[model samples]
Target: MEVRLFRRDETDLLQLSIDTLWAKNHVLSRDKQLLNYMFYDNPVSQEIFGEENYGFLGTWLDGRPIGLMGLMAFDLNVKGMKKFGFAPTNWIVPPEYRHTGAGLLLMREMFKWNPSVVLNLGITSNVARMYTGMGGYHVLPDVPRWIGLLQKRKTAEMLLNGDVKFLRFYQEITAVYNQTTYHVERRFDPERWNACYWATFAKRSIGFARGASFINWRYFQHPSFTYQLFTCMDDKGNYQGLMVLRIESILGGQAKIGRLVEFMANDQDSAICLANKVVEIGNENELLFIDFYCFSSISSWGLESVGFKRVLKSESDKLVVPTRFQPIDLETTHMMAALYVSKDVQKKISLIDDQAWYITKGDADQDRPN
Candidate 1:
């Protein structure tokens, strides 16, 4: 078996593996535009790996592809410095080929790139176990999830079958707020966004770089989902923060939900303003609830201050709220993650500290369509 990086022209071969092993109707398998948008059109990957170096790696036996692993390469921020990083996605090998060590081979090949960090978000329990047993990887059991109810009684009915007992206390917590000083816009201004990142988030944050190019490609240029961008500006008309949201229909359009994919701010005040704006938008749209998944104390504090309650582990285990809604899954689920940071990178920044990292559901393939 030969393990190597697949060329950009080999989409057919890669799609074959995805269709056969991952899922028959995955968006990546059939939508060439979406596939290229993810792997080929990434601005960060293009800058680091040249324009022609795509992110797919495959294991071929006798010139026939048998296994596949997709990598989403990006620039990681460490103490305001850019470092190469990648997240693995859609890694699969058919049962017939799993014993041949094709999976391991693909992983080893990825490591050959010598990325400063290898971060995996939205993983399964089985994959989590494997990552922990591998030694040198830091595994986070769950990334915190926060929910805010727009219409308490209606949300309770839709999510808990009219079990307003648990929501009685929160019912009085109204979504009404005084007009914010920040102005919100539905467009992307690349210059202002890059300036905001350099002036604020990059100075102290440790996570994926959120420059203008990344945001444009991840949210605006996405072919599968329609993401709405809420760009906040201060009284001086300076960029303060950004919030990416998507309104989803669940339970066969009987209910609507607000999914906050990305939340970035220049400071606590900006964060609070953005959070309040999200609540206002949710109420106006009559959404059942608004949910955000992230791993940052600053973000949590701001969200909680605006009435977003953390979804506890106990509640998640009991299926109090379902995370997946494309087809509506009722099973218990949490966002699991793992990170392998190089020793040099670890010295500069503490990737192990959840407080130091600014990860969101938008980080990897977590917010993608079903």
Candidate 2:
């Protein structure tokens, strides 16, 4: 087997590898709609993450691609200094060649590039174990928060199973939504990924260095998906929060799923207002449910107060359980795995807990159309 970095000229080869693997691989297979969106329609990876950082491929003795792993570049704020890191994604190996250790070989090559940090925000059970065995720590677990709108069956089932309690002062919670006088506006500026916009978010202790160029390439310029960006403002017109949303038509367009792609707020009040706006928009469009993944306790509390519920994966089944509300274990959450090679980056990681770092589905390729 041979391992190598993907050349810029091999995009078509990359696409062919992905399509051929997904179509023939037994462990996972996707429909053409997803396949097309993932590899064919969207060619923005190079422009968004930089051509040098996209990732690598493993080939058989005959030079046929048998394994693949992709990485997205991130300009990170490391203790107030700008640094670069990578988010590893789409790690795949065909079943027939699993025992040959092609996946591990690809991973070893990935670390050779020596990014400040290696972030894998979405890891399956098998991959999580593999990463742990490779000296990676599950730094952040993905606990997806949800608010059901038209999912009457699921909600009633939860209630009958003694999983929910009807609150007495529901009006008080609803009042929070009204207290913050916010004006929400939808925007579609291709040039929106500017330094000013990123500066607003950089106020946080740590986060992705999101700028206009990155945003346009990742969301607005995507070929097969449409993302709606909504900004909330106070009475004086100062920015309070922003929400990126995408409505996915499921069940052949008979129903839709409202996904809170990316959310950032200045305070609990802003978060509450943002949550309410999401619900309003979802309800207006008759969505089946509204769902999001967050690691912030304050944001979680604000969301729960306004119709949302926290759901964690069951140990025995991947199906969601109505877990008690609490701050999730950052180090054990498989979805939040991290491996830092630099001492400087490791110190920053220890300084702040996982929740202190800003993240959302939008950080990775997870929320994309694929």
Candidate 3:
């Protein structure tokens, strides 16, 4: 078996694997648009990250594509300096190639490329084992999925009585808001990252280098998913923070799920304002629940103040059963990916505490087109 990265002109090979994976199991079809967005059309990638020249990982057996992995490049922020990292996504290996070690071969080739860091946001249990077992990489703690019940009475009662088989929640609960100083309004500005945004990044010890091009590619230009952007403004009408929200229908459209995909703020108060805005939006739509994923202590505190409950899970768990009252696998359980922080990169930033860095589902390919 020989492992090689897909050349820029070899998109046909990538599309072929996508077709094969989808034909074998329909669930893989959702990954097609996301893969395309990452490889071909992302403006940030084209302009800064040099994604056009970087080929995805593919393992060949006798000149036949047996396994593939989507690798996306991003400019990571370390001590305010720009560095590059590759996020491994959409790992595909058919059953016939699973035991042949094709996936591992491709991964080894990926590490040989020597990125400043390797971000694997959507890691499966099996893949997690494979990555960590290879050494020189550390696995982040599982990112807890928090849920805020729009109407807690019925759901709370169901939890206490052990009757968790439904996905519907009562819709009469009033949203509580603590952000009295600032107000929020819905906006369509994808290039809203300003000096304030870069200043926020400058203060961070570690995180991805966020900019307009990256934001537009990740959320605004997605082909199928519709995401809403909310801007927080002070009394003087200055932009204080930004938040991105998305709602998904599940259980055959019987349930509406809301997610706070990304949020960046100047302070705890601004974060609370953005979080409260999403809560109010969810209430207006009568959503069953609204959720957010992050490791930031400030954001977590603000979100909890607005009725969102912090849910935790073991790093080893495959499925996240957020609420016992109505357990549904509808929400994707995003495990922390394996990271390879080189000694040079580690010297510039601290990875000791996960909270030291800023992260969201938007960091990796988690909230992409699919």
TM for candidate 1 is: 0.92
Candidate No. with top TM-score: 1
Q: What C-alpha RMSD separates each model from the true structure?
A: 2.2, 6.1, 4.6
The lDDT of model 2 is 0.58
Error of 3 at 337 (Å): 3.0
| lDDT-based ranking | 1, 3, 2
Q: Per-residue lDDT for 230-317 in model 2, tens only?
A: 7667787666666788887754545566777676666677777777777777767776556676655434655676766655445543
All candidates: TM-score: 0.92, 0.74, 0.81
Predictions in order: lDDT: 0.79, 0.58, 0.65
TM-score of 3: 0.81
> Could you give candidate 1's per-residue lDDT for residues 1-370 as a string of tens digits?
9987777778887776788878897778888887888788988766655676668888898888888888899988875898879988867888898999999999899888888888889888888898898755988888888888778887767776677765554532243353667767777789988988878878778888888988988988888888889888889888988899999888888988889988877766677777777877787788888889887764676667778887665652444466776655656457889988888887886645656687788887877776
Best by lDDT: 1
C-alpha lDDT of residue 72 in model 3: 75
Candidate 1: segments with Cα more than 4 A from true spot:
165-181, 315-317, 351-354
Per-residue lDDT, model 2, residue 232, is 69
Tell me the spans in candidate 2 whose CA falls farther than 4 Å from its real position: 22-54, 95-101, 139-144, 148-181, 188-200, 312-342, 351-354
TM-score of 2: 0.74
Superposed by TM-score, candidate 2 places the C-alpha of residue 95 at a distance from the truth, in angstroms, of 4.9
